[model samples]
Target: MESVFTILVLLTTVGLSGFVTRVIALKLPLPLIQILLGCVLAWPGFSLHVTFDPEFFMMLFIPPLLFADAWRIPKREFFRQRGAILALALGLALVTVPVIGYSVHALIPAIPLSVAFALAAVLAPTDAVALSGIAGKGAIPSNLRHILEGEALMNDASGLVALRFAIAAAMTGVFSLRHAFLSFVMIAVGGLAIGAAIGWLSIVLSSWFKKRASDEDPAAGVIMMLLLPFAAYLSAERAGCSGILAAVAAGMMMNYQSLRADMSIVTRLRIRGTWGMIEFVFNGMTFILLGLQLPHIIGSALIAAEAQGYTHMVVLIGYVLLVLMMLHLLRFGWMWGLRWLARRRRQRNATDLAVSGWRPLIIMTLGGVRGAVTLAGALSLPILLPDGMPFPGREMAIFIASGTILCSLLVAIVGLPMVLHGVSGKEDGLAAEERYARIEAAQAAIRALAETHDQIKVGLDESATVRVADCFARVMDLYRRHLEVLGADQTADEMARLDDQVDIKLRTRGLQAQRAELLRLRRRQKINDETLNKLLAEIDLAEAALFTRSRTV
Candidate 1:
């Protein structure tokens, strides 16, 4: 009960801090703010020792987060960049482990090669949420942004797999190249199979439920949507496969399946909003937990080291930074190798190939943002190895992981701003691309509504005919104005004003008519209160979407 209560309070507090970060607008990043605040809360006087269980944390956080990310990514873009994402996510990670592992072992002889590889694997998973978040604000190219996001999404499984094998090697004192390679292939393929089966079942089930669903009950569809990620993860784990990849694959399937589900627009919108908040809390709480543990780990390490005549805080931090630098160097070299490989194959459109010169490479290396995953993996290390002895360099390992994570984040949050100042072309290009995409999307809706309007026109009375025409006409006009604005040479502020004006006109004429008709139907007892409310809610959502689109591009 206490733990639950603590979590609730922390989430509430963390949420407020996030809000505060937005309100303040130009200070530190929210993750850093949360981490710093967490450090303060971790002060001895504060009795909040927020603990975590590795299995529980992975189960609770990883699936939903990865699922949401995978679901949201553009399916076409993801697959198109599949080779690049895989190379960086899996290939680079595989390389990073041995390279960083060797570096760590060489830098600090006290830490075993196996443990160093474990730490390296932990750090290899770049949770680029923060980088991607700010990248949307401008600076990073759209193609680059896709690469970052894709790599982040797929790399979790690779990192986890690496960590697993590294741990196994550590415990048994044996590292088998062929055996590990076979295991990787098995886990990945098996996870995909399981996830695909689950995904197909979900789609079929959701469709059947939709046939019987109503607004109030919705045939338990939303519940199933929430349950699917957990189902994928658990099932995959049981089958000794990559649960992370399973959840991701399931999410990717659900993304398209959702289009086929006969769900209300309002319901879908509600799901997005709910998941948004859930992710906020999950990521926030994890980062806060990380900060809360950091000081304690450092203190513990220092005390133990002092007694044993080992290195203290300053030396440990320097060593961690050194290893961090090596990770960047390794990434730099791998990136060049990728560039060379892409050139050899004439892969012009690949993200890494598109990246010219060493400047982007350096930026990308620095931009590889590591966060809660690194810290969590480090903290989750077993207290004792398979031999029932204390894990080697446990304290130092935690410190190094924490420090490296901080550096990665800081490099992105602090350094990227300075680097990106010299670069703004991507922002403008991204905006134009978005405007074009939005126009295309709206045009699609326009086509659908036109077909619907035409089909129903022949059977309807004059009043219904006019209403049907207006439905399609209003949407078509919205798209027209959107395309017009994109071609205009007006300032952003002027364009925004035009958007607002059009949004108001559309809401006042189209959505308002729908609401008025619904009220009239209710008054005449032609429609029940429930049906009227549902219709009204749908109108409200349409109005929301109209204004929302205006803001997005």
Candidate 2:
């Protein structure tokens, strides 16, 4: 009982810290702060004896996080940037490993080339969580954001495969480029096939379930979406393929199909909220748990370095900083070269839209912040090699990887906003377009309502029809009056948007009144719990619809 209570308190504290991040993020980046807080809480004085198990950690965290990211991303746009994404995910990661490995071997003569390459592979995958945060709110260009997201997802697979090959070569003293290539292709393709199959199965099963269930069974739909990522990941892993790729592919497939499905608006809203909250909780838990593991890792690393006869821990720290510098240099050079090549290709092809400027290259370079994936890879390293000797440079690999993660994170947290300043967000243009469309949609809705008035009146009784007509008349009046205030030449989309906001405010006033009345009835005991809940639900649904409609503008 005491153990249970202690855990409850600890988790609550961690969750509360996550919530506090939202408020403090304006001053310090939420990701940096959360990680720092985690490290601090890992102190022995806290009596937190956390253990690190790589396989278990990956199984717990990777699937849902990747799925949420993929689900939210725009499928069509992501595929449009598929070329750039593939280059970064596969080509750039492949380049980074050898270059980083070469540098590591040069610095630390004790570490074998293969082991260093393993370290390189550990660092190869960009931390998806950090990338997502750095690109949060889409402060960077949309095209670059899409590439970063896609690269982060796919490179986890590529880097892991490379890690496997590096370890094999280290253990056996034999390496074959051809075998590695074939193996990578098999793993990637297999994962994709498995994931797509599972995704289609999920959709079919969901359709079958919905056919039998009543309209109120949104839980059934939400459960299906929640189960999909785990199914993709586990099945792929069981098949000896890449679980990360499986989860990502499954998410994309599900997202594409869900977009085309004729799902009810309420179910869609519920699923969005449900999945959104789940992702938020999962991210917070991952970082907080990562913090709990810091103490043991840092201590072991220092001991290992001490055994090497280093005078001060500063020597190990120096190696970490050097590795970090190498990573940044390699990343910048790769992105710049690729961007230049892309521009040359575009010019040769005579494309109308001029190629993107250097900002994307700079942003992508700066955005190479590492996060949970790097940590997982480093921790996942086998404690002993095939010959039973302590894994060569294993401690250094973990330490270097952790230091690189912090460096990348601090750089992103401090640098992203500076680079983003003075740059315009595309949100302005999108919001404007959305507003114009919403105005047209409202006009159409009003006309349709008028046309169906006769049928609506015939179906309803006297009092009900009168109330319905009064509501319809008011809504129509609002739209007509709002549009009359707009310009003739569409001079400003913002004008219509502001007017739409005004319409939302007017609708919200009624919702507020309904809410107050519902609460009052409950307080007076004039209604049973079920009756009060039903009335409150109707009001809640109305407000939700109104909120969604307003946001369309």
Candidate 3:
């Protein structure tokens, strides 16, 4: 808890410094700035020491972060680009370990190969949130963007699994390929099964509660929702499966299932906003914490390994940069080869090849900053061997991994913007136009519905129809505004603005109606609780759908 407070204060300072730097037009990556700040604070006397703990860090951070990221990745895109994602997430990670291990062994001959392998594994996984700045810049095409995001999400799981195997082999003094392979399969599949079960049960529980409850308490429902990820993850791990994979699977499943549930537009908006803020804070703190850990690790290593002195440190830093560059080069080379083959196949089939945008691939590779998970894994390394001696090269290995993270962040921030500039000209204006066209189509549908309602009201008796006519008139006004905004070039923005206004109006009107109806029911003393609850649920569902549709578009 003290550490958490320290982290919050340090992060707040880091954020302010980053803002100051940006305001003055400095061009460093935010992560880099945070790392430097961490270093400065850790210098003796500043006293911002964070004692890294394995279990606490993993439990507090990884699951929710992974789940949130997986939930938002477009399921359709993930499937479509599954092959590329697999190659990078799984294949590239396998390639990275041995390559990085050998390179580090050559650079630091004193370090054991197992320790080097562990370090390599730590640095292999990419942090998806670290790329938010690049992605938010809107420099990549939709296809490439989705593919990059999918790759990041999948590789997080893949990398963690690989790291675990490497760690287990290091600790047990045995590395069985057969066991490792079987373990990976079991963890992944078992986690998936666990996640599915949790998702199913959650839905059942929520439905049961919704059916029997009389107060219509959505807060209770939201509480149940928060428990699913943690429950699925912890339960799977307790059952000898990957908690990381379980959390991801559960989140993905929940995101899919929740689409059909009854929710008010207000609730959805509130939830989205809440999750977005959570993710942002988590990401910012994760990077800052990673940065904060570096100076201490590196300084400690320098003191412990006195044989080679600062020269060794300098050489190791160079090696870390080499390994970092190699990571990017391999990913880029793999993507290039894959795209070339894809293009050849498309030509053979007389079909247009999907554009393999370079900027996104660049962003993806460079954005691979080893963060909280890597640090957590590194700290999890056994402190002592079976012979009662300290784990060989553990401190030095952590230093190298931390240094690699810094190098990766620097490269990404500096290189991504240039790549984006080179490729921004190729954006598909035609696609944007098509999206605008769809907005018009939806607006037209709404307007047509309003018009039909107006015509139907015209044929009714004036006394009986006046109230219904008034409703249609209000609805017609809404549709007219929507239609007017549809064909505009800023259609997405315009629709979003209109949708917000509608949500506000719906909330105000729905609450007023509910209050009035409740009074009427109380006066008559004849309202069935079940019927009244069902009506409320229906209103909530309609309100939810309005926001969902608007946002989805």
Candidate 4:
């Protein structure tokens, strides 16, 4: 194990996992697989010599992963399901900590209340990325997915905040109700404010840099965009605010502001590719880390059991599992009851409401698996308490936290697929939606083209109008062909070829507009050459948005 290279082994695992996932359609969750792999690596003869710094692990991995999730979740869905999201993020975490704390203290009497609470806090929330990948495989409703994702995204921050407060209490040997309450409020509010401010600044800075770029090197503006999230997060953290929230806010702000008109197709492609890779690697590594830690966590527990006077760690493990089961049951019961109430209310009011089915709600609750953040918080537990004594039950607490997380991951990865299967497998609704969107877009495009042609016919001289009308007819025919392609009236090959031609024509027209603007500005001397470049970039971004919308349709 010492002779073998660690990085090479981890990378090999990642590559193998991906291959297994794609080739065999391995139905198991990737994280579960990764954790299993780690356990195997750590077992007796094959013990892969690996060590991780707690702070480095948390700071390096958590921020980017959380930020990416936040960035992808839409504002509309986030707000719509905010109540549920908050319930899970803040409210549920508060409930979970105490429940786990009480259960742990009862089952393992030697573990101090403070240490138990700290461990409880660590296992409070599940990993969103894991849930999404698992739940997304099923034909769950998009709105339900949004709620789960949003909740997962926000709860991670909330869980970390709780963990910090619990750690503070454990270290200082004092817990103040007022102080803890205030601290929670301050961290959440301050983090939000700072995140927003940083995000806005990043947008402004990125926009300014983009405007200053030369035509010969459009890619120069890209570097500023890449730096924005990191700068925003680090700066906010330095200013005594939550870096996680700050990173999320910056990513969300960039998603809204920078994705607008003026973004080149090339830029959009680059941004998507960059973020996709970031998300993939981060998720992959997280799973691997969790897997690697499993053997260590179990080994530590076994060693500590003798000193702690606990003969059956398995009994304690079972108790932890029971607590988790109860929490999930509570979640399911709440979701089901709330939805039933909502349905009744809608019926009484004679109002139409889109009810998110129960399957997703159930899956969402079960999906909570503790991840790297939990491990980080657990590891960060102080070596000593305020009285100069070793932190009570530190090793036992770590074992329990790690065990609960592993158990949660196992349950989620295995159970989610089964849960998804029972959910409505109907893609008809989404297919219908896609069809409707395409028809509407096609009709709207036709009307716009018709309107433009009408204006041209009216403005032109009688002789030129005929020739122009002929050109207009050709454009109309092309538009009709587009509609046919969308309607699936055209062959797939023909549609593909025509779609390429349509994109080329659109790009050509955009270029023509830029040329026209440049010529007009040069003649008048009212606008500088720089203005043309800026305006053209803006136009390109706008065009790219339209293209993106079309593709989605």
Candidate 5:
């Protein structure tokens, strides 16, 4: 009962934070607001005690969130930017682990080198979710955002795997670099292959069910879809592989499967809306949980520091600041070196690079914000070694990880807006692509209508054929006008624009009338609730379509 109550409270808090963020005039990011609310909830008067379980948290929240991100990211852009993503995700992890490990050890000799490396490993993965919340929608250039998103998706596994090895080294007091490398390669490859196979198998089974089942309802399919990430994660972990990468691979496979599958519109929309809500709730809960843990972690660390002959909280804070500074410095230098090499290669007529400018480099550096994963990894550290001795620097590591997450969020919240101000995001040819798609679809519709009309006219009486032809002509003219609008001269363009305006107005007004009549019928008992609801839904969808088209035009 207590566990259930705690969950209810957390859910309510998550929902209320969304409301508060909107109601407040400060315009703070949602994650920041949720974290603050969490801190408030952690007060003694609240009596809100919840245990933190790292493995469960990762399994519960991380897989679906990562899957959603992978599913949504443009596959072409992800592949196109693979080189940069791998460099940051894998190569940078390799670099950051050692550099940060040595730095942490040098600063606090009390921490063993292995433990320091563990801390560094956990901090390696960036939180693109937090970055997006801080940066706001469409704030970063699209290309840079893709790269950042890809890096975040891939680095989680790398970081966690490194942490696992670090923990092993700390426990056994022995380490093998070559063996770790081989294990990482096997784990990563095996996870990817397993995830892809599972995803493909799910698609095949779904298709089989669609053929065998009589009902068209999408509930069963939606439920299966929701379970996919968890299944992938658990399966890979059981196989001694990287579950994070498995979830990511499964998500990527989902994108490909969706493109090829002939799914109902209802199923697509339902899946989209469901996942949107899941992403929101999970992300909010993750941050709030972080906030809930902060006071205890920091207070305990401060007390431990005092016992160790350090008297001030500032000393611990200084360590966080110093570590954060080193991270940014390393990120900036790495990116700058990549840019220089690309520039030199471009001079040799090799190829053009996607990311350019020092400002973007700075934005990317600041965008590398840490979040829940780092804290979870830190907290997951074992409390006792094989010799029955307490784990060295566990409290300090957790405190530093928590502090780093907070500080990184604060820094990006303050720094990103300043850097992004007055900077224009580069156009990624979306408008041109949209225009081309519209023209092609319109042409196809015209062709299909013409063919259908010919078939129908051949079997009808002259009068019926005339009526049928008239109906088809009216629908076909709409498509023709759309095509004309797409490829119009200056004068024709003005006329087409006016026609679109008048058409949109008529359609919107008609939809509004339909909705009004629907409600009126229900009020007068002229229609059953089910009938009214079904009709109203159609009307609402029409209105939404009109609104979307108006905005697009």
Candidate 6:
């Protein structure tokens, strides 16, 4: 009962945090707001405490969130930026683990080398979720954002794997480079293969069910979709593989399947809305949980530091700052080197490199903010070694991890805006693609209508055929006008665009009037509740479609 109550309280807080963020004058990011609310919940008066189980948290929160991100990321852009992503995700992890590992050991000799390596490994994965929250949506340039998102998706697995090996070494006091390398290769390959196979099977089964019962409710399909990430994560773990990468691979496979399948429109919309809510809630809960753990982590670490004859809290904070600075310098240097190599290979103008490189480098550096995953990894450190003694520096490591997360968020919160200020927003590059798609779709509709009309006219009487033809012509005319509005000629395009805008406004007003009348009918008991909802849903879907078209065109 207590566990259930704790969950209810957390959910209530998550919902209220959304409202508070909207009402408050500060305009703080939602994650930050949730974290603060969590801190308040941790007060003695509240006594709201939830145990942090790192493995369960990873299984519960990480898979679906990573899945959603992978599903939504632009596949072409992801592949295009694969080089940069791999450099940051894999190569940077390689560099950071050793460099930051040694740096941490040098700063705090009390922390063993293996433990320091573990800390550095956890810190290696940057949180794109936090980056998005702090930077605001579309605030970063499109290309840079894609690279960041890809890096975040891939590095979670790499960082966690590194942490695992470091932990093993710490517990047993033995390490082998060859064994680690072979294990990593097997884990990554097996994870991707398993996830893809499972994803493919789910897609095929769903398709079969749809065909077997064409009129079935979409709810079952949606439920299955919700379970795919968990299934992938669990399956990979059972196979001694990377569950993080498995979840990511599953999402990518689902994306591919979606392109191939002719899924129902209703199912597509339901899947989208369901996943959006899941991402929001899970992400909120993760951050809030971090906040809930903070006070305990900091207090315990401070006491431990005092015991060690380090009386000043500033010393610990200084360690966090030092770690953070090392991360920035290393990231900056790696990025600069990659660019220099690319320039030499491409023979690009030095002037172009000089003009355009620094801003993005800075943005990427600041955007490398630590988040929930780092905290989770830190907290997951073993409480006892093989000798049954307390694990060395566990408390300090957790404290430092928590501090780094907060400080990185603070840095990005302050630095990103100053960096991005006064930069003119670019027109969405995909607008042209959307317009072209709309035109092609409209043309296809017209062609289909004509073919159907020809087939229907053959079997009908003259008068019936005329009426049918008239109906078809009216529908076809709508498509024709859509095509005209998306015209290629400059002057005609401008005029048609204005005319299309007027048409949309008129349609929007008509929809509003219909909705008002429907509600009026329900109020006066002229229509039953069922009838009202049925009509209202239709009206809402229409409005949604119109709103989407307005935004794109």
Please give each candidate's TM-score.
0.86, 0.90, 0.80, 0.78, 0.95, 0.94
| Cα TM-score of candidate 6 | 0.94
Per-residue C-alpha lDDT of model 3 across residues 1-553, encoded as one tens digit per residue: 8778786786686567557557756655555556566667667786688777777777767887877877887786677677777777788777788888788787788788888888878777777666655334456555556666666766666667777777777777789889888988898789888987887788777777767878745676766676777898899889988787788887888776558657555456556777777766666666667766777787676775567676866776777778777777877777666668768777422211135456555655565656567677777777898779998888777777777766776676777677666555234764677668866776777768777776777768877588787876777665555555444558665775667577667775786687578758956877777777777666666666666545533
TM-score of model 4 vs. true structure: 0.78
Model 2 ranges with Cα > 4 A deviation: 1-10, 22-26, 305-312, 347-357, 427-436, 443-447, 454-472, 478-503, 548-553
Q: What stretches of model 5 exceed 4 Å from their correct place?
A: 305-311, 347-355, 426-428, 488-491
Candidates arranged by lDDT, highest first: 5, 6, 1, 2, 4, 3
Per-residue lDDT tens digits for candidate 2, residues 416-527, read 8888887655656566776698678768977887887767788778899999899878867766755654435464556766777887888789889988988898899988
**Alpha-carbon shift of residue 232 in model 4 (angstroms):** 2.9
- Residue 136, model 4, lDDT: 58
Which regions of candidate 4 are displaced past 4 Å? 1-9, 24-26, 40-48, 216-220, 305-311, 340-361, 386-388, 425-433, 447-478, 484-553
lDDT of each: 0.79, 0.78, 0.70, 0.71, 0.89, 0.88
Compared with the true structure, model 2 gives a TM-score of 0.90
Clashes of each: 0, 0, 0, 10, 0, 0
Error of 6 at 36 (Å): 1.3
Candidate 1 backbone collisions, by pair: none
Pairs that collide in candidate 2 are none
Q: Show where candidate 3 strays beyond 4 Å.
A: 1-37, 40-43, 134-137, 304-307, 344-361, 422-471, 488-553
Error of 2 at 87 (Å): 0.8
- Candidate 5 lDDT over 362-445, as tens digits, reads 898999999999889999999999999999999889988998999999999999999999975556486688789999989888
lDDT of 1 at 201: 93
lDDT of 3 at 367: 55
Error of 3 at 321 (Å): 1.3
Q: Which prediction has the highest lDDT against the true structure?
A: 5
